[model samples]
Every structure is written in structure tokens, then in C-alpha cells.
Target chain A: MQLKTQTRPKVISVLVMEDRIDAATAIQFKERMRDVTKDAPARVVLDLARVQFLDSSGLGAIVAVKKLLGPDRALELSSLTPTVEKVFRLTRMDTVFTIHPSLEVAVASAASV
Target chain B: MPPQPVSDHDPRRSSLTLVFQADPVSIRQALQGMLTCPPLSCLRGEDRGMAELVLAEVLNNVAEHAYAEAGGKVEIRLDGDPRGLRCLVVDEGREMPGGQLPEGRLPCGPYVALDDLPEGGFGWHLIRSLCADLAYARVDGQNRLAFVLATGS
Candidate 1:
């Protein structure tokens, strides 16, 4: 899985370039995320607008990436497709990570703060 | 195109069976190969996405816990209807932890600390929540799990 990253004023949005995030791609996704987020700013937004299929393994990968970012830095997920959002809501991970409807909103919030 | 609502006597009901290796690649290939099915193909992307997500979780569970990545076979049977789809997964690798399914609910946890967050237990929760009906049985030395989902075609 290839991740696209854009660094703005306060937030760096990492756009996930994939349609499916399941068992087949979860490991690679985590590895790629670790590399992309190793030196990110204080707050980062993960843009998942194109991710239409996300399962448990994929969710775990996200959590693992969060841990890699450490305590001070924050990881927020944005642009969740309905299916991906359903998985997060069902697992109650929606409450764990801050969510936004779009990357623009997330970035704007970062600018506000 | 949308699939019409199905009845008991509807001729559109169809069944398919296949044996797959208990592995992620095989399970993914199996699901990918199913895109041509009528009921699944007719459903909207979100519904199909949920179905595929649930199916992938279940299959990965079998490969991880049951077969332990050594080697095993999973027999899958899909019952297709114009209104919905039912799937049966059978494997001989292992039984449920205590001969029963998990609570099928998310275990509450504090979302505060990074160490306290969960990573693995979410699979069964996702499966149980998305599926309409889920049944599990350990019969004749095989772990059989049957689940149904609405196609919303």
C-alpha cells in the first residue's frame, strides 16, 4: 500500500492510496505507515477517503501505527468511507481516535488550534 | 442493476462451494473471485464492502487460531439469494476457545493510554456486528460457522 503525505501549516495529511485494507494488506500498511509517520509533526491526519474496505486486521494496523507515533503526537483519521467507518464504530475505535469527515476539516481544525 | 427481492421459490437462489487454504492470500483470492456472483455483484459498494470485511476477518481467524499457520483447509459454501447471501465456513483445524463463540460484543476499555488500547479482539466484534445471523457448531471434528448478510441490492 502506497501512502501519500502532504505537510501543511500544523497538520500533515497522509492519504492512503488503496481501496481495500484487509488481512492481505494490513501488514504492509502498518510498515508503510511507520515509515511515513516516523518524523511527522505534533498532529497528523490519516486520510482514508479511498479506502472502501477495512476489516479487523486493518483496524489493528491503524492502532499499531498510533502507538508508533508515541504519546505526545496525535493521530487522527479523516475521510473514512462508510464501510471503514462502520468497522471503527462497531469496534468502538471511533471513540478512541479523533475523526473528521474530510481532510480539509481536519487540517482546518489543526490550524485553529 | 439491482437484484429483485427473492422468495423461497425464487429460481435465483444459487449455491457455490470451494475449498481454500487457511491463509490470507488464499482467502483474499477466494473473495476476489466472487465478484461475478449475481447477488453480491448487484449490491451497492458499502454493503459489499461490509460483507467482504466480515468474511476476511472470519477467514483470518481460522488461519491464525485454528490452523496456526501450519497448514489446513477451509471449506466454504455460499448460498446466494436475490435478497441476501449466506456463507458457511468449515475447518478441521481447531474448535472455539471453549467450544463456544465469544460474547460477540466489544469489551469496554479505557481509550486514554496507548498501552491500554486493544488491537486483536476487534475481529470477532466486527464479524458479529456486521452479520445478520451467525451460528457456530463443532460437529464431526469440524468447526462450522454459518453467517448471513443482507445484500441490499
Candidate 2:
């Protein structure tokens, strides 16, 4: 459940340094996200490029993080691998949050907004 | 090059059986072992992804819901063919409520409030969507779940 955090002016990008987020690590992932994004700006883009797999528990943790962020702070997602993307798509969580193809695009969009 | 024929009796691609403690950490290791082995290892792209997702959900359910705090052991048998992999999961934990599987409806709507957004209950929905012929039975004192994950080949 390692996360690399890079904070810019308007957005904070937390890159997941793990290959899989499943039942084994979902709770740890959520707790880490909360700590990393505690002082996040308006947008927090989670970069999941290295994550090759995410189960339902992992998805729930992400959603839990979003709710933890509340209405003012937005939790966005970027760089979803095919399998991670499939989990979001299948659960229809894709429609709940804004998803970017890459971290750069997510940061750029956040900067403009 | 022509596609190689896949046979059920092929010596290199035989059914995989795994027995492990019903816990998250053990289930994770089991999933890794299953995916890297024959038949599952032979899957590509979406098919492989689906297999992992479905298996994770099923195993996690057994650990969290079925076993709960009581703890138990789970046995998984996977037989793969051209159409898909047929999975059988057996556990001695408590049977599913009502002696049946959940309907696994999508938890949230397109316009649900942020606070109302569901943080769980998506496991069964995912399993149902990714697998076919999903069935549950309580034979003797064990819970038996069966499903087929198509490779789309």
C-alpha cells in the first residue's frame, strides 16, 4: 500500500507504488490515502499506472476516500490499467468520479479548473 | 502460425486445485498462484483480468462473510477449456443466508448523493457480471459455489 505523493498548486497526485490493491490491502490503502490527501487542494488525482489489479474491496476503499474528501475536495483518478479500469466500469463507479488517461492530463485539467 | 489445439486432457494444461486458509492474505497468495499456473497463465488480456477479479471476489466473500470470525479453510478447483474456466469453491464455513446467492444488483444510481454512495456490496455484482452459470449449493455442512469464467476465445 505504498503511495508516492506530489503536491502542486491546485492538485495533488498520489501514485500507487503497488501492483495490486485487493482484500489484503484495501484498509491500508484507504488509511494511507486519507493521510496523504489530508491537506490536498481542490483536486486529488490518484495515479494508478502501476496497479495491475483491483478487486471490489479496493474499489470500495477508493470510494471511501472520495467520501472522506467530502464535497469541496474532489478525488480524481488517472492511469488506470485495463483490469483496474474494468472494475470501475463494471461497478459503474466510472461515472461517479472524473477519470483521466494519464497523470499529466489529470493535472493539466485540474490546473485549468 | 496456426493456433494450437487446447485439450482438456492435455498433460501441460490440467485442472488446478488449491486448498488454503480462508483469509485475505492467503486468498491473495492463492490467486497469484492460480494465475501463474497453467490454463489461467495461458489466458490473455481481458480474459485474464476477469479471471482474477472474479476469483478475488469469490474468495474474499468466503473469508469475510461465510467464515466471518469463525475462520475456516477453502478449496478451489479450476478446470479450463477453450470456452472458459469452470470454477468450484468449497468451504466449511456457514452457508449463504437464505441458502442462495445474492441478487448482486448495482448498488448506486447515476445521481446518488456523495454521502449516500455505497462503499461496499459490489463484490457479488462483479462476480455475476464476469462469470456464467453462477450457482450456490450447501452440500452436507460445506458451501459449494460454481461458476464459469469465459475466456472469450
Candidate 3:
């Protein structure tokens, strides 16, 4: 799995090209997010349109990334598959982060904030 | 802790082995049976959640890592006493990722920082956190992951 990063002004976008985000892909996830967001922005959106599955580890990763951004920046999740959504709901993390239907919507929503 | 008395009709008093191909639905069914079968009554709601999380994560890992490229077989073994449950997942596919548990868990306890959670490193962390003991071994072209979850009486 490869984590690609792109910066657009106040928003940092991360694209995860993986069917599942588990222990194997979590570190690369963190490094890429950290590398892209070295300079914090007002909003950070992760485009998980391709991810079909996520576990607690994956959830923890996102939570860690959210913490890295601290309370100032907005962290938004986009394009979460149903299984992935189930995991978020199971862990009750859906309430912790902002989730959107698509990357465009997530980024746009973050931009609005 | 003392060994609790086994209840009548307890299935876990005897070792159980249930093997399923890389089918998610079947896997869940088997898990449902294994977790509920008599002696394992200790697995209630919260333990059910924990089992679901652990099973989903590990089985998905097997499906992707073991059978992603070419279909392969996955074997699940359950062994336990009245004290706790042990699950072993063995897959005949790619080799297990090589390395020790991440350095982050050096000081294990609650109040661990969420920010310190490594994005990808959460697999072992979650397995370690959810289970009392975890061991991994690659034997004869198979990745065997053993999980031990204690049910405090």
C-alpha cells in the first residue's frame, strides 16, 4: 500500500491506495501524513475511497494522526467503505472525526471550516 | 488465578479446530460458533466485540496476505481452559512480516497517548492490547499467529 500526499493551500490531501489498512500499512501511513503535514494546515483530509477494510489499528492510526494535528486543525475522513464505516462505528470513532462521502466533499467541507 | 470449574456441555473443555477457506462469511459463522460453544460462555457482549475486532483484523490479514494473489487455505485452532481463550490462525500464503513488536509498547499500560499510535503499527499493538499474550511463528511456509485472551472471573 502506498500513501500519496498532495498539498492545496490550506488543505492537505492524502490518498491511500490499499484495500485494507492494517498493521503493515499503518507506519507508512504515519510517515506520509507527517511528511505532508510538517507545516500544519487548517484542514487535513484523507481520501480512503479505495480502502475496503479497516481495523482498530487502522482506526488508531487515524486517531493518532488527528492528535498530531492537535485541536487547531480539522481532520476529515472521506470515501469510507461500508466495512470501514462499520469499524468506525464499532469503535465509536465516527463521532470523533468528520466523515464525508467523497474526497471532494471532505476537502470542500474542510475548506469551509 | 484458580482454574474455574467447567460447566456441563462445555465444548471448550476439549480442544476445537475449525478450518475454513478464505471466505469471510464462513469465517464469521465459525467464529460465532466457537465463541458461543458451551465452555466459552465467558465471552459476553464486550468480549464479543473484542473477538470480532481481533478476528476481523487477523482474518482479513490472512485473506489479503495469504490468499490475495493466489487462493490459499487458512486454518483456525481454538484451545482453552476455564481461565482464558487462545486462538491460533495459520495461513499458507506469503510469509509473515518479519520483526519484533513495535518499540512503542515498551511501557505498556492505559493512558497511552493516542497520538503516539503508529498508523500501521497498530496491528500488533491492538493484538497485544486485546490479548494477554501473542506469539507469531513462520513454520514450513505458513504464518502462524497465536492469540491468548484472558477472561477474568
Best by DockQ: 2
Give Cα-based local distance difference scores for all models. 0.84, 0.92, 0.67
Candidate 2 lDDT over residue span A1-113, tens digit each: 79999999999999999999899999999999999999899999999999999999999999999999999999999999998998999999999989999999999999997
lDDT score, candidate 1, position A21:
82
Select the stronger candidate by lDDT from 1 and 3.
1
Query: B73-143 in candidate 2: lDDT tens per residue?
Result: 99999987767788999999988999989999999889899999999999999998989999899999999
> In model 1, which regions exceed 4 Å deviation?
B1-12
Instruction: State residue A37's C-alpha deviation in candidate 2, in Å.
Output: 1.0
The candidate scoring highest on TM-score is 2
Per model, the share of native interface contacts recovered reads: 0.81, 0.92, 0.29
Residue range B63-137, candidate 1, lDDT tens digits: 989999876999988888756788899999888999888886675565558966766788887787778778999
Q: Is candidate 2 or candidate 3 better by DockQ?
A: 2
DockQ of each: 0.74, 0.93, 0.16
iRMSD of all candidate structures = 1.3, 0.6, 6.9
For model 2, state the Cα shift of residue A33 in Å: 0.8
